[model samples]
Target: MKLLYTTLLVVVYIIPAINAAQCLSGQYPPKPERLLPTYVVNLDAPPVERWQDLASKYKVELKDLIAYLKTFLVEISPELQYLVDLVDTKLPAMADTLPAPYGDEMKGISQASGLPLGEVVLYNIFYEVSSLCTSIVGQDEKGNIFHGRNLDFGGLMGWDKINHTWALTEKLRPLMVQINYTKNGQVLFKTTTFLGYIGSLTGVKPGVFSVTINERNIVKGGYIGLIEWMYNINRNQSFITFAIRDMLTNSESYNQTVKYLAEVPLVAPCFYIVAGTKPGEGAIITRSRKGSDDVKLLGRDDLWFLAQTNYDNWKKQPFFDDRLTPCIKCMQEKGKNQVTFESLYNVLSSRPMFNKETVYTSIMEPATGRIEAYWQLCLDEEAPCRPW
Candidate 1:
């Protein structure tokens, strides 16, 4: 009797272990009813309504729409035939690849669009569907186990995974855009120079050199400034004329390109001077224009002038002393240049000292002429000084 009781207990334990393993491996007796809530949603709706909507909304032909949607659904949930049918009827044809649950089907769309396979995947998952899922999940009930709407268990997994993936990719977009713009600008520059060479060889005056600028091709902000500078310096008036024409026609590059004007050597120097100061620094200088005004100065020691004449001598040294001395001498020669003093003071006070290794870049067309020194004051550590 004792032996038989021991045997029965061992059998009970073994049976449960086997069943647990089977459940984990999904080899257990089918429990279709226990599947997630997505299993219950009707994937099949009226085919005519679905096809018409897909055509109208997504602008995909009915047949292609049906095909892609079918593939997309199958990738997300193979067993959920009803859900697939529902998607076919309810959703528009996916013109773009979707991330995660539907990512497997992206291969086909990537090929169709002629975009890199990686980029197509990124656009679909990170840029498009990730935003869509975040919007959906935010609206979902806090306790809802079924986190995603219009998605099956597999699709939900994809959405969850894709969100994590996008967090990383989104951070890299700006950096990628910077690199791409730099590379493209270099290529375009070389191509323009080559064409100029070809024209020279044929004994033909290089016709008006034209540059097409579009947001898609150009980098935003500072890099755009850099490109404009390069174009102006290399191509001269013909390039400027072309740029002006584009500007008048309201080209996308106009706002950035047209702001630059040729004013001889003074333009480049003035831009260098202005560019050296931070944006708000100039405003601060303007506000502190009067000598009687009290101003709070932030102690930043990064100010330096580009030493144009003695490059070899000044190459290793900061141009702070040489730059400031001229302004100081000028201040003495003609009662303190108050505006120049305030501008320099505000800049020194407000901006942090940038590292010596940091690169400063700007673009300005040089034209000939000089302007009077507006204001100058000697920077004394304790007080602003001027020779009477």
Candidate 2:
């Protein structure tokens, strides 16, 4: 009887603990050549209906997707309570400030995904709240100005258990959602992003401009109060990437984009790369967490290449992101006067700069409004075998 009881305890508790340990400690497999397949979503219906259709279509992954995002937030935010505080307190006002169409869209995403409106709002601002990236905006030998970047965030950080398990269980794949807007009727504005997300990080407006952002830490600025933070949330009633989406939708030219980017309000300080089809229109717009008055702009009318890594080159401070030198050197040696789409691709995919954490790589030909993207470098199957 004693032996049986001991055996039962081992079977019920010890074995399960060992299994859980194995599952948690499991190594991630190489990313498949693609994360998610590409798909197009038209925002032509009422915001709720549009998001509802999107949610229903992707219902299988919605729960896991939220879990995957939560793991990252739990790892990054000061504490889960801070995020909860933001959602409980600031989210409503932030949502209220959104152009009605976008707010309705958020409601739709929340309703369809069965996620609380606060979670949806927090997820939409994830990058704004925390992110890491590097971007380049300079002209090739042929006067072709291109915008290129590698989005680097915490990938293999312990959040893997959630992603790996869910991915395996669901045969899950990543997706690039090409969003088309119907706000003013037949707008040329379009953005490509992950499925279940509703903001622009890297985007372009054909015949207008291309834009991307890099994070700027506000450690030196000290803590900001919630009331003060929300007050500075918008320049023309948009926040974070929604501002980018709005600009791409409404701005018709590079100058117009610069004006909007300059005037835009943000809850955080960040580095922006804006490239235009016209000569002398491309620039790096530096944003302050405070307001537009503190905003700064820099661009070159004459340069074979223009770029920004993680730090503020405009301030000429002693600080520079570790990746800056390698990126610049890569462009000069491999891309020099021979800078072509292929060369840009090579540089982004080259040593020092490229790594396991790189989620995606993209190059935009603003002059022609064309974009070439390679998703999942770790599992690079070279889906985009050719670059124009």
Candidate 3:
């Protein structure tokens, strides 16, 4: 009955749309047709000049995100002036610590768009300091690997209360972009990211592996720590997205990928979910700021599938904010016959798992090097179903 309902829903909403209402139930809206733009970066091109083309293509997006994130990051600024002062003068000095191409990439973007370098630098690290997400990785009966995720970024400071506002998410729709970093015309890796942001929460390397990062909340209200972490040049901490980019750039196999993710010293805590072409090539690298607390792999001891939300697998999630249990249950119920991409999408698109803050959904099959992404629309849909 559920399968029939979903099939019908997909068929009925087959018309191409940007804000269509096609619910699997009251909550799950499957396969939104909103496609994000894909761009290729020439690795041979100078890092500071590579993104100059994109800067022109998304001039407004570049300008708007900088403006928005300035307000967003400044609201919680500890001294406020400290945050303002850093962006204004110190961004150029961050070169030694922030990896090579990233600093140059942002510089390219700033120069092309004619936007302030300070705000552009701050915008790229937005996810480094904060985000919420859910991810699942599993193997089919045929031993093929599949990965999926929902990226949830919410933090709008209202005068009375900080809240999850859809205005930002809706405004974020057009900013979605896929970056294929290539060398000599061969693609090295791909990232589903925003136009100007260099780092990624989701990415894949064909025939190699796929990775996604989820914000792991260890300590509550750690913005002060994050503020210090980003500016502390001596910490030698890896920006989470840059770490993912590094692994995709360097690692040749799944084992090496797991090892790298576990060993890297991150500037913030996160859940790094990885899947590869081989059968047992999936793991969730649960990380702390300095080291990995744990690494949970799929296809181990018959654990065919693994799901991660914002919390660690060993700890009990608070009832008021539990998406892990339901997501796992959904995966188990839908992924029974054959672990197809649609099965993973069904689990990811289910209620509670697919909430108001979910900005986008991604489904990946690493074996064939196939990946698909869709913007989850939160327009005037029914109550409890809308992202708003």
Candidate 4:
């Protein structure tokens, strides 16, 4: 009886254990191994002609081209080490900023270039090459391949599809704008706007002007250039209308914002007139500092009427034909006499939104209520002034 009981207990536990082992094994699968292809080359022969011939004969996959380049780098590692040493010695004097930690510096570089930090760092180490090297590494629809110019491992694979360029190239341009507003050295607004105002200005329906406050930072000197660029691009009221509509309502990614606006009609002419205020003041003063003391607000009612009138006049006049000149000469001529807020409004209000401006303001004036009023017009699609 004792032997029988012991045998039954052992069988029960053994069965459960076997079943548990099977279940566990089924739950966790083995990890798949990473496989990359190998390329064989003959060192005895001339290499340049051989690569050219191969590229001509076959559609080399981007992956295979990268691997080939890596092998080539390994062959010339010693030479590359010497060059790196030279660079390390010379770079310190040229760089104004101290070297950031591997991680932090990479983060900063990525933020600056608008590229993925990891990819940027990798390219900086392995694929640092001359423009000649870039030209040599012919780009195909699939990938790029190259021989050494600055170093052996100079070829980069996997060009970003969305950006349609190497990750490193993307890192060359500043991706974010940092604004610093200070009050007698006390920081007020120090903030970063990604891709800065470019995305906002360009992504909107083309000619519409929109204003955003970076409460953290106030640029004391840089506002003039920004305003000028805004004026140049947004002189058309229809474009302004479209830009405003998309900016307020569109959900597309910033990259696709231009694509969305491309379809919209460029209508009402627009310009940017920026004004700044002291830390405590609610008043807006023009970058040009030409506004009257009583006109404190940036976009007051008087300015709105002026912009509307300007748009109306702009539409009525002969479409300015001087595409080559930096400033529209005819448009400026029309605006010359109409510098004051009241004069601009009086000229513009006489005509419909679509009618061209017969008169132009040669001297630039501050943008006031017109900017906000146009925005309001956009909000109310039913407004009588809304251009179809």
Best by TM-score: 3
The sequence of per-residue lDDT tens digits that candidate 1 reaches over residues 1-388 is 4345334533643233222211011222224432211111011322122122222332223223234333444332344243344332322233222212233333343434333334332232211111100000010112111100110001121111333211222222211100000122221111111000011000000111111111111112122222333234321222212222222223232123223322211101111011111211110010110111111111223222211111122234223212223322332332213223223222222111111110111111111111111111112232321110
Candidate 1 Cα lDDT to native: 0.20
lDDT of 3: 0.72
After superposition, candidate 2 runs with Cα above 4 Å error: 1-36, 71-74, 85-94, 155-175, 180-187, 220-238, 291-302, 314-321, 379-388
What 10-residue stretch in candidate 4 is worst by lDDT? 145-154
Weakest 10 consecutive residues of candidate 3 by summed lDDT: 14-23
lDDT of 4 at 156: 29
Per-residue alpha-carbon lDDT of model 4 for 1-388, expressed as tens digits?
Answer: 4345335433643233222211011111112221111122222233222223222332223223323333333332334333333333433222222121223433444454443333333323331221100000011122211100000011122223464323322332222222222334432222222221111221111122212211101122222322232345432222232243234333223223323333333321122212211111112211112212121231243221112111111234212211112122222333433233333222222212211111111111111112101100111122211111
* Candidate 2 residue pairs in clash (backbone atoms < 3 Å): 35-174, 36-174, 36-175, 138-306
The weakest ten consecutive residues by lDDT in model 2 span 19-28
Off by over 4 Å in 1: 1-178, 182-388
CA shift of 354, model 2, Å = 1.8
TM-scores, in order shown? 0.15, 0.75, 0.85, 0.17
Write down the lDDT of every candidate, Cα atoms only.
Answer: 0.20, 0.59, 0.72, 0.23
lDDT order of candidates, best first? Answer: 3, 2, 4, 1
Give the per-residue lDDT of model 2 (tens digit) for 31-78. 445433444445566666766776667755765655666654554434
Give the residue spans of candidate 3 off by over 4 A. 1-32, 74-81, 95-97, 157-165, 220-235, 383-388
Total residue pair clashes for candidate 3: 0
